[model samples]
Target chain A: MKVGILGPRGTYSEIAARTEFGEEIEPVTYPLITDVAEAVEDGEVSVGVVPVESLREGSVGETLDALAWLDVKVKSEIVVEVDHKLLGTKDSKLNDIKQVLSHPQALAQCRKFLRKNLPDAELISVTSTAKAAKQVSKLRKKYMAAIGSSGLADLYDLKVLQENVQSGQENETRFLCLSKEDSEPTGDDKTSVVFYTEEDRPGILYEILQEFATRNINLTKIESRPSKKALGDYLFFIDFEGHHEEEPIKEALEEINEKVATLKNVGSYPKRF
Target chain B: MKVGILGPRGTYSEIAARTEFGEEIEPVTYPLITDVAEAVEDGEVSVGVVPVESLREGSVGETLDALAWLDVKVKSEIVVEVDHKLLGTKDSKLNDIKQVLSHPQALAQCRKFLRKNLPDAELISVTSTAKAAKQVSKLRKKYMAAIGSSGLADLYDLKVLQENVQSGQENETRFLCLSKEDSEPTGDDKTSVVFYTEEDRPGILYEILQEFATRNINLTKIESRPSKKALGDYLFFIDFEGHHEEEPIKEALEEINEKVATLKNVGSYPKRF
Candidate 1:
């Protein structure tokens, strides 16, 4: 099987893809989340995996935008424990590190650790954690270090200066596998939908959400993203506790469709969170 | 008055601060949103201005986290038009650019322009757009360019290679002025609140929204962010049309307080959207 991921291997996206498809599948890397979704839509890969949300960073807006605008379905949800380690050259010690590099989100996640330990170190923001590791490896400077998964140390020939550098005890990221078709009804599934309301009035969302509330369809997530037309305009993305093909979920969606200007059923996949 | 902003100067946050306080206020620069909020809470600055959301990028997670966890209050909302320009040394031409440096969001916002014009250029992500411009200015390399506000060209002694390079024409960002106290009741105002529901079941959020619906309160925005405790756990941030001091809004808060595990009235400020 061929899988698409946010690239520069050894990142969390690759780990999520590997966890879902095993180690034998061929991995294709894309620069952005939209590119990965496009690859899935164009059938260049059997499936594409992208980070949807992280416990520390909330939801990934690009992935959400891709799910809203792209012609792809979510096939599965993968949760990966984000374990960031301080990696440096073999000759370097933690005290010798004067500069750190990682993706912005990763740097933010390790803020507390960095502030407490490397107080004066310059934090360099890169495109990805893998790229940070690659840069550090190529430079081989004793004063430089990178924060990423332990898998990166082996991939880039770096040493683990410190383990578990992320802020909270539980740092987990949720990834979505995209493909042409969603998964079959597994009895236990979650459905995701996006909708936009043309009218800006009181209780429009309240009334729309009532469809699921009346049917006792539990919602897992609800987020309002700017529609890009204006500041107050929003596109609501919702995830609920049943598959789209389920009877109650179908009835609720039908009711919601009538109330909203536009509705897109993103997909249904087995619940992972 | 001293006002805190995310800076190296010439950032949108600085512009938002200047827009709200006029150009005479002393601008204090912080490396992170949390630090700006801390400056406000510690009374180091009379107020702090931070970007809360962008039309294209959705909400700023760090800003949301600061509002939810800090003691500072939203004094005002400032909206700034994001006008991205391709800035380079005066000696350089557009085709000479081989690397484009910018904050991740700015880079993402101008993705179309970069992909079309500098297709093969290495896109470098930095901590902030001002930093990108500063780096480009310091290096003075013909192959280096930065995408940021046009004000940056003047601040960093660079020339605008192209104006309005952002993808959309209507790109705007919402910023919040944080102080010790929220604004007094303006006839037309907005209230922001954050709440957490301990129960993970159907209708909890719907029931909470019904409080505002029945009260005929219009919500300007509603977003769910991970509570940082777990993946499915969330803390809801709601912005509605009224001051917290109003009778109807007060009643709704009382009702919501009884329903949720924790409820925090973030602030009420004059509506800007």
Candidate 2:
């Protein structure tokens, strides 16, 4: 199978893509998630991968927004572990490094480490962990190191002076696999939908949410993004704990439609393990 | 007091900063949000002005996260009514313009206008609205126009091809007046807090949320961000309807703290009109 992931190479999506399918799958990298989704929609790629949360940044709003717009659906999910390691030149000593380069998320994950360990080092956030690794590798500058994947260290030919140096021991990123073709539900599934109210009115959200409460349909997550149509109006992206075909959820959503002017079911996919 | 705002020469923030306070306030411009928050935290600047949401990009998580880390509290608010206008060179007629150049947010807000009216024109997003206007001005690039403020058109010496082109009649941005010293809450008040619970232990969220529900406290918003501490663990950023000093809110928080490991009361300020 041919899979597409977002990257310039060595992004967490690349890692997730490989992990999901192993070496048997030929992986293609796209600059943007929208392109990856478009490739699936246009049948250029069988599946696409996107991180649930951003590795370079924090949240991937643009990807989620694109998902809402696309006709494609999520088919699988994977959790990829992330550890920001301090990569340096082969002969470089860890304690003497004066500058630390990393993506914003990596810098954040390793904040506590920077505070107590290399408080004096200047922190510089870049576009990607791999880019930071590449910069340090290319420059071969003394007193410079980067917080990136150990895999990237190998890719750029750097040494991991410290292992799993992130402040948080258990840092992991959740990735979603997308496809244009629908597959049979694996029974255990998750449904994602986007809903927007008719106008900016009070108690409207309460009434809509009441349907889920009444049916005891637990919502996994809910995020509000600007509708761009009007001021104060928001589009809520909600994830519920069951497939769209499930009775309780189907019934609850049908009830919800009466209250919301816009209701679009993005997808229903089996829970990936 | 020194206030830092985004600017070039005649940008809105530079004008707004001067108009808000007299020449007594020294205003500086910072390229990134994190720098502004750091300036506030380090006491290099007395206050930092930041747009609550990016017009092209939507809400910025890194900015909010940086503000949270800086521990700087918003002292007041500034609401700027964004009047997005389509500006182009004198030689370029509106119909002849093949590309619509604007900041991402403006392009997003004017989706309907682009689709319904300028269907022939391809939309191109730029770094900033001022930059877009400047591009048209400096380059005199034919068949290209920018969606920016009317003032920007004047500054760039570009003709206004279209006026008030944003989808929302009230295309506005609320700028926070942040300070290192937490000011006394105004009588008409609001409080914002960030908290995290033991990850996905069913009913743990319910326990904290029930504290508000049982107390009849209204929650304005509840957003979950990765705590970055571990996989599956999340930090909940909540904005409630009542002030922390109020009886019900105070009691509800007291009960919430018992169940959660960490709860930080970020700030209490006047509710912006």
Candidate 3:
């Protein structure tokens, strides 16, 4: 099977894909989350994996946007523990590092570590952690290092100088496996839905949430994103316990459908978290 | 007055600061949102302005984090129309641009423009749009361009190659003016609050929303972010239509406080949206 991921490889999205599909699957790379979703929608790939949220950084807006707008359903959810490591060329020492590079998010995650250890180092923001490691490997400079997964050090022929450099100890990223159809009913599953309310008023959202509350459905996550039409206007994405096929969930969604202008059922997937 | 902004300068944050204060106010630049908040908290600047949300991009994670963790209050909210321009060296033409550099969000906002016009041009992520313009101006290459506010062209000695390059036409970014104290009730103000519920039971959030609903309080925005403690754990940031000093809002908050583990009133600010 072919799996699509946000890439040039060695990203947490790839790790999530590998964790879901195993090592024997063929991996196809896309530059953006939208691209991965498009590939899944077009059937160019059997499945696409994209990071939906990180414990430290919160939800990935692009991934949320893709889920909200794209014609793709989430098949499963994958959770990966983020293990940020300081990688440098073999000859480089922690004290000799004058500059650090990584994706901006990764750099922010390790802000405390960098401030205390490499206080004067110039922080360069690149596209990805894997790309940062690649640049450091190509430079072969003793004064350059990258913050990423230890796997990057192996992929880029660098050494892991330090492990768990992120500020938070329990850093985790949640990824979604996207396909043409959602999974079948699982006893332990989660349903994701995106909806927009045409009217902006007091208790509009409260009324919508009442459906779930009345049904006793536990919401795993709820976020409001800009509708792109206006600043205050929003598209709400909600994830709740129970599959869509379940009677209570189906009833709640049916009731919610009456309160919102547009509603899209993103998918029902086995809950991993 | 000294106003801190997320900047090298000419960023939307700077524009927000100028909009909130005035053109004559002294502008202090900080490299990150947290730094801007820190400056305000430390009295390095009387007030700080940072982008909180964009119509196209949603809430800024860094700004949200700063609000949750930093000792700053939202004195006011400012909304600025996002006018992204394609900037380049004096001699650069649209067709001659081989690479585009910008903050990741800016680049994402202009995804459609780049895909249609500069199909093969490399997209480079920089620390900020202002930094991208600075880099492009320094290089003075016909093949280099940056996506940012048109004001950047004047600051960096570049020319505006194109106007309004972002994907959406109705793009607007909401900014917050941060200070030691939140604004006094303006009658038409909004209160922001961040809270965490220790219990993960169904209807916990719905019950919290009921406090507002029962009192007929309108919610302008509601979002859940990872608490960084663990997966599935969240800190909810809510914006409601009332001043914290209002009797109904105060009563609702008291009820919510009893329900949640912790609740912080981020501030009451004039609602610009």
Query: iRMS values in order, in angstroms?
Result: 2.2, 5.0, 2.2
Q: Which wins on DockQ, candidate 1 or candidate 2? A: 1
Candidate 1 lDDT, A1-273, residue by residue in tens: 899998878899999999999999899987677789989989899799998877555677778888888899899999999999999999999999999999877888898999999999998877789989999999999999999999999999999999999987448889999999998899999999999888788999999888999999998888886686554566999999989999999999998889887899999999988
Tens digit of per-residue lDDT, candidate 1, span B32-117 = 78889999999999899998877555677788888888898999999999999999999999999999999877888888999899
Candidate 1, which segments miss by more than 4 Å at Cα? Answer: A230-233, B230-233
Point out where model 2 deviates above 4 Å: A54-58, A115-122, A181-184, B3-45, B49-52, B55-58, B62-72, B77-175, B180-191, B195-221, B226-234, B240-265, B268-273
Residue B66 error, candidate 1, Å: 1.6
Per-residue lDDT for A65-130 in model 2, tens only? 666678787777778888678999888988879999887567777877877888899877565787
lDDT of 2: 0.72
Interface residue Cα RMSD of candidate 3 after superposition: 2.2
Clashing pairs in 3: none
